[model samples]
Target: MTGGREGRVAVTMPQLGETVAEGTVLRWLKQVGEAVADQEPLLEISTDKVDAEVPSPAAGVLAEIVVGEDETVDVGTVLAHVAPGAPSPGQRAEATGAPPVEPAAEERSPSPPSGERSSPPAGGPRHRHSPRVRRLAHDSGVDLASLTGTGPAGRVTPDDVERAARHAAPEPVPSPEAPVSVPTRAAPQRVSTAAATEPLPSLARSSAPAANRAFRTLVAEVDVPAAQWVGSSDQASVPVPGSAAAAVVAAVAGALRSHPSLLAPGAGADAGDLAVSWSTGSGTTSCLLSQAGELNVGGVAQRLLAGATAGEPPPGAGFTVSLLQDTDVLFEVAEPPPGQVATIVFGTPTRRVVVVDADGSPGIAIRQRSSVALSHDPGTVSREAALAFLRDVVRRAHSRA
Candidate 1:
């Protein structure tokens, strides 16, 4: 956030991730000359890592829009300007040369560029199809130019392409004896279990450019005695009745505090106040815990219990943890949610026979173990940093157990 001329504030494109160099302005929530409150959502922007709403820097009237919807610009570029104090409609119009309120329908809908196919005469309006939408249209054998857009400012969204595809006549199926010619294109990367239920078309509709980003998954096996420790009621050292799941969450939070670099590069300097999104059976829940590093296993358990009972977790977290303890899943690769740096998944713990070093002597023993996998955007979190964070989590979990 920066100050501009005439006591106005500049709303620049924010850095959504460490490797995100640019972003596209998807929509402007507040039109020019519209009164905006401080920290109010001013616009929505899409980057490779996430799609997020950019908030206003100050309470004032939106004086000017330097960047329009669907326009891509470098990070830190001024997207708009807001003048402090309430200025009259006439004064605002004179200062910015924009209408006092929303523009007329005709003025709002601009003509498509030359060489682009124009919409049919009976169509709603001209629209700009994003690359993902165009690809989906091509794959589905749907003509984007002929479809009516339902998105903001007449944008051709993936839904329109999917709808068109579903309505179009199906092509004849090739016989078993016929030869097939596969298109020469790179295979699409697999989405994580978190999004496995969603259709490909729906995934394409996501604001984050998942196809363009590089992701890495790391897996580690950890010995967890917390499962037994939590089940036992006779332990005198137990500060509070906590579940193994809550202990894992506390361990991850502590690791995040110790290794700040494991967080998204754009996650600011204060790592103590971190938000973590965790998965319950019903759905995902986000919780913002202050000084999370300082929280113990019992403290985290209480919070989790409260959130589950209330059906709402604390809002805001750039990290996610998915617990698949009850299932037979051994390990899973989970993609981080949009705008988040990484996701940690815990698989079901099982008894395993292994050799252990006891008092400097190797011995055969049966132990309980679980596989923890960390999926992260390599651009935001380095491989080494992720490994260290995972190791720390296991270490902390063992100590707590």
Candidate 2:
């Protein structure tokens, strides 16, 4: 290990938000003595609202594991340390202040708690395991301290937990009236008796049905000549205020203003109207419940992008629009989250824009071609209203352009 604080870099728990003072270490991508790159995903942290992959601050060898898996620690707490390069097992032990103790000769066989690989010493460091393994152990009522790990460096794995569980379980006692060996043809009778004696599956414990969604889809193509822009032609060199997403958002918002009934009154209303908001970047399909009845498309678009970038939920919008820049794929289907009126997914140009020549010849033209999908609550917004809303958006887009 490198000397002093010169080579060692402390890996601290980050402050995700003003309210989030602590977070749980969900998983570590690199183990002790492993090399890691700067900005690479080092570990996963789970907060109340988001699960994020925390990136490494600098490229180095993971030298120490301070905070164990599933351990919750306050923000700025040092989770681990990184050195300049990888260290040998002996060197690692020396660096971490751990005594270098080898397994006894009798512990050669690879079995849980067998031979010299029994439980750790009373005051010695406990065997290191992953968050997943610890969680499994907890749920299965297996004692981590009692089981010998089979993973590298004797770290407890999920497999070790499972094996411990099997060993810890009590065997079922045989009934006084045991049945004699049954012929192959009579196996069904034995199975029937076993089934009859077995307890039925707990209905209440079973997973519930998927939540209901009022889904609606609208597919339309609007012609947008390359010249369609909001800025003055004199300032042609300057970038336009409207991106493909922003323009669509503004158009939708303006159209919704015409039909105010489509806008929801508040969040969490089962059958209320919905407001429209647009999203930036690619991610899981989601709706931001918005209460802004009359909204500025440009401002709302900026806010949506900023909020998503910060890993915060967008303001309440009855319908959320996600603009996907990835154009390689031609089509996709997305559903709205429950409690929202709808989620609109707008795709980049897919189909070609063309113009008919006066001589009846067809030629390709430069235009923006988008595929729009609206997943709406059928109970609150009818299919006809959804289609009309989409048409109005196209009209607005054309008029603005």
Colliding residue pairs in candidate 1: 275-317
Give the clash count for model 1: 1
- Which regions of candidate 2 are displaced past 4 Å? 1-214, 224-242, 265-308, 312-315, 355-364
Clash counts for all predictions = 1, 10
Candidate 1 local lDDT, 69-88, one digit each (tens): 99999999999998876556
TM-score of each prediction: 0.42, 0.36
Clashing pairs in 2: 216-376, 263-273, 264-273, 264-274, 275-318, 288-317, 289-316, 289-317, 290-316, 290-317
The C-alpha lDDT values of all candidates are 0.60, 0.52
Index of the highest-TM-score prediction: 1
Best candidate, lDDT: 1
**Superposition TM-score, candidate 1 onto the true structure:** 0.42
Please write out the lDDT profile of model 2 over residues 1-401, one tens digit for every residue: 33336668888888888899899998786666555667666788988767787877777556777887899999889888877553455545645565434443234221222323244456354466688776556544567888777888788887787566444543233232332221222211100111012211111111223453324455555544343222222433322224445566666666665443244434322322333322223222223424323446556445334333312224444555555444553322344543455555555554464464746877666556655655455455555456667677778766644
The candidate 2 region of ten consecutive residues with least summed lDDT is: 187-196
- Can you tell me which runs of candidate 1 are displaced by over 4 Å? 1-212, 226-242, 269-288, 309-315
